[model samples]
Target: MAALKTSTTWIKGQEFESEHDGNKINVDGDKKNGHGPKALLLSGLAGCSGIDVVDILHKMKVEFSDFSIDVEADQTEEHPKVFKDIQVTYRLKTATDNLEKVKKAINLSLDKYCGVSAMLKKNSAINYTVEILN
Candidate 1:
């Protein structure tokens, strides 16, 4: 089995530094120094799926520009709050004829390729929308 490891160290109150494969990020629960952990998870989901979609689109010969993803989640009110649902919006400038191809890439990413999406879906309902721009 392939294993990936990361390390997180406490920096100060509500602040921590996490490192993986020589990359590092600061996570702060207070949101004063860095992004909160929950927010980072949402980013991870977007990044994972985005990478897959880009690769799939490239393989399909679909050209696109200004591609971006916006992710939002509704969190439960209870302690140990968790995401109840997530909304992912994909926007890009591409040929109108490529719409179906883009959608297919995104679907394949979320449904089959994105490990982060697979894990997040265990607890949160994930919804996605695609917008094509000129």
Candidate 2:
């Protein structure tokens, strides 16, 4: 297996600049400094799943507009806090008839394709809902 690599540089006051491959991201332990680490994880989850969903939907010939994924996770209150539960809402502006197909696409990503989901699910409970807007 090939190794994935990243490096982080300190930027003072609970802030860091992380580089993956060639892309750089600002991460912070404090919200005022940059994006919180956990929140960035949530974004990664959404992005990973979203990519799968879009590709799956295209192959399924599902046309949609205003596609969005909203993620909310609850974290533990103790030290070394972790996510207890995560909820993902998938919103699609498409025909109601396409709801079933959209759901199928999401299920495929969450259950079989998304690596991030697979990793996160090992520790946190994940649930999802679909909303169709005409």
Candidate 3:
């Protein structure tokens, strides 16, 4: 088991700073000013799965020139809004022959490796697609 800790403190109107593992992240309620909590959560999901995919692919000897993830999520209209649906698009620049291996790596991340995905999926439905550019 692992224990993680974080602290958040208000900076100003609708803005705050979150500290974790010696890093600080600025969060704002106004989307135009900075990332809101929900948006950050979506980014976390993508980052978590992206890290997993990279490690899995490396272990499998799959090579890629570039990789990125794009995520969009729908939120409930009611108070205490939460994500309803989330979609992730993984874009990779790699050899055509590695497409199947890349997909397998993504599947492993989404289905088994990403803790962020597991937590969010308890409330949100997640779907994903892949795009390979060679």
Prediction RMSDs, each to the true structure: 0.8, 1.0, 1.2
Q: lDDT by residue for model 1 over 1-134, one digit each (tens)? A: 97989999999999999999999999999999999999999999999999999999999989899999999999999988999999999999999999889989999999999999999999999999999999
Q: What would the TM-score be for candidate 1 when compared with the true structure?
A: 0.97
Per-residue lDDT over 75-128 for candidate 3, one digit per residue giving the tens place of the 0 to 100 score? 899988888999999999988888899889998998899999999989999999
Best first by TM-score, ranked: 1, 2, 3
Off by over 4 Å in 3: none
Q: Which should have the higher lDDT, number 1 or number 3?
A: 1
Please report how far candidate 2 places residue 47 from its true position, in Å: 0.4
Rank the candidate models, highest lDDT first.
1, 2, 3
Relative to the true structure, how large is the alpha-carbon lDDT of every model?
Answer: 0.95, 0.94, 0.92
Residue 42 lDDT (model 2): 95
Per-residue alpha-carbon lDDT of candidate 2 for residues 1-134, written as tens digits (9 for 90 to 100): 98988999999999999999899999998888678999999998999999999999999999998999999999999978999999999998999999899999999999999999999999998899999987
Candidate whose TM-score is highest: 1
* True lDDT of residue 112, candidate 2: 98
